[model samples]
Target: MNVAWYIWLWSDGSALQLQQPIVSTTRCDRPIEAVTAVTGGFEVRAFLFQSDQDNCGGGGVVPISYVAGVRDGWPVRVRPTYGPLATCDPQSLIVPLRPGGVVQLRVDTDDRAPIVEPAQKYDSLLVSELAVSPYLPEEQRGDWVLARAARGKELICGYVRMDQIL
Candidate 1:
């Protein structure tokens, strides 16, 4: 499921430009919302159109009717598979679960699972409140565990308390 991705940015006539507009099969008009370089690669946050109909080529123009209003930006990993510094290869932020990595979520009857943004207990944004179910373990963050689950169109990646997993 490896896909070609490019972080499209409107240059001030200073940065290097790509010979060809990076096209995506899943989205159109991918403007550079944010970019952060991690250990292995960079994580890009961009507003990806949910449509595959057309490639607007970064003109910032798309058929307005096709869009369902502005959606939340998603984080895409750009690893070594990228062509050049200006280009990127899209990867999922949430690591896939390995065999025997499944765990059951423990919560009270009316309690929802708390999924936070950072690994810390303080000042972390509450990403989502998931229901009790079988969850795939992505990674461990001290007293918290990073978990991944699909809740509609977006993939939920956040930390849950270690005591919440059974």
Candidate 2:
């Protein structure tokens, strides 16, 4: 079995952006609630895409997580996946958003896995949809000018070396 995983960030109701080339990694067993504080009354979503194959068969899975804040802004949510190494194709993950909030996505892999390609050894992390307005009509029901400012998208990306494991 082989699989590739990545993270995405969506904000301000614009389009879901990709956050690749992750620069850091952290482990948290709790739901992310901090994001609500940052977005006011926006929504957050996370997803995992997986595929596998046994000597006699094949299988795959795509799991999605969505959390909505009651008022505005919630907390950061973190989850983990368990399985064998899988190959990730280019543009395997996609995120959706409206447009004045910020969203960040990241991907990590087990360092113990044997490298099929040296270039693939690097884990890609991307950060997108930073500081914008929601693309939703309700989000823009108020002041029109302010609404336009809120409806934009921003993104970032980086990488984490295996030797820097914490």
Candidate 3:
């Protein structure tokens, strides 16, 4: 089960083309910064880069969609034999995160933390941590955060404490 993965990305969140598939590889294993499911109803994933030296930019090179399985709504697992052209840019192939954009983020805890309702008055725990977006500052609840978690296939969203995140 040795599969090579490629993350095809577009800044504007454009659709992936089937005719020509372009992709790039990255050794950088960065946690997802934010996520949103508002791209015409489809989930949009994004990663944040603090500096250009981080090599997180896709470097003007566009990526193509593949038929392989998708992970985190971005990275796709393709066959090891599949060969796509390599990028000449200095930066690793990664799409930069935009302001107010969303990407899938992970909880920085070994123990499962409680997922609470953001709109609830009392501590209404839903489930443990699964996936989350960045801390919602607009909510003005400094300790509370908006998060999405799933047991199997069903996805759930709620507010979690900021201390639970990395």
Candidate 4:
């Protein structure tokens, strides 16, 4: 687990495999607490370090509320069937903007304005989304823009790597 996953909150019906309750140099001592039975599984309300040996500096506690837990069926691990974030293509960042597109908009606010640099010219935006132009010879269709929300809807009409899309 990376440092980003420091505060682990599980809302499902499964109990986290945690460090044993006993204090030892090998594992955290009683780091799990506030175990409450929810609709499905248990929701931990508190997690503390009972001993300084666990790196809590003696009674260090990270409250469960401060932690970011799954919101519904929380902690959803979506293995993208397509896009730069695909399970196998970790090296690929050129995702097409089509249906099942999982890449996020990386709009850079240059002086609080949208930077319109060409594709691959800027590092802030995705290569696929920035691959827009009126001169390039046409090819297959580009990726889809699925931005449905309450209000202020927008779409990215641009070029995309056909091979990267579904």
| Per-model CA lDDT versus the true structure | 0.32, 0.25, 0.30, 0.28
- Count backbone overlaps in model 3: 5
Candidate 2 TM-score over all chains jointly: 0.18
Candidate 2, residues 5-119, lDDT tens digits: the string is 2334467876543332111112311222222323422233323333332212212133233332221121212222221112122233222323222322122232332222223
Candidate 3 per-residue lDDT, tens place, 71-97, comes to: 334222232211112211213222221
Query: How high is the lDDT of residue 38 in model 3?
Result: 36
> Candidate 3 versus the native: TM-score?
0.18
Model 1, 1-166: lDDT tens digits are 2234443434576554333223333334554444454554345444444224334554233221110111021222223221112221122222333222333321111123321232322222222222222373434223444444333443333444445443
Q: Rank the candidates by lDDT, best first.
A: 1, 3, 4, 2
Q: Which candidate is the best by lDDT?
A: 1
The TM-score between candidate 1 and the true structure equals 0.20
What are the runs in model 4 whose C-alpha is more than 4 Å off?
1-26, 48-59, 65-101, 104-166
| Candidate 4 lDDT | 0.28
Which window of ten consecutive residues has the lowest lDDT sum in model 2? 143-152
Worst 10 residues of 4 by lDDT: 81-90
Candidate 1: lDDT over CA atoms? 0.32
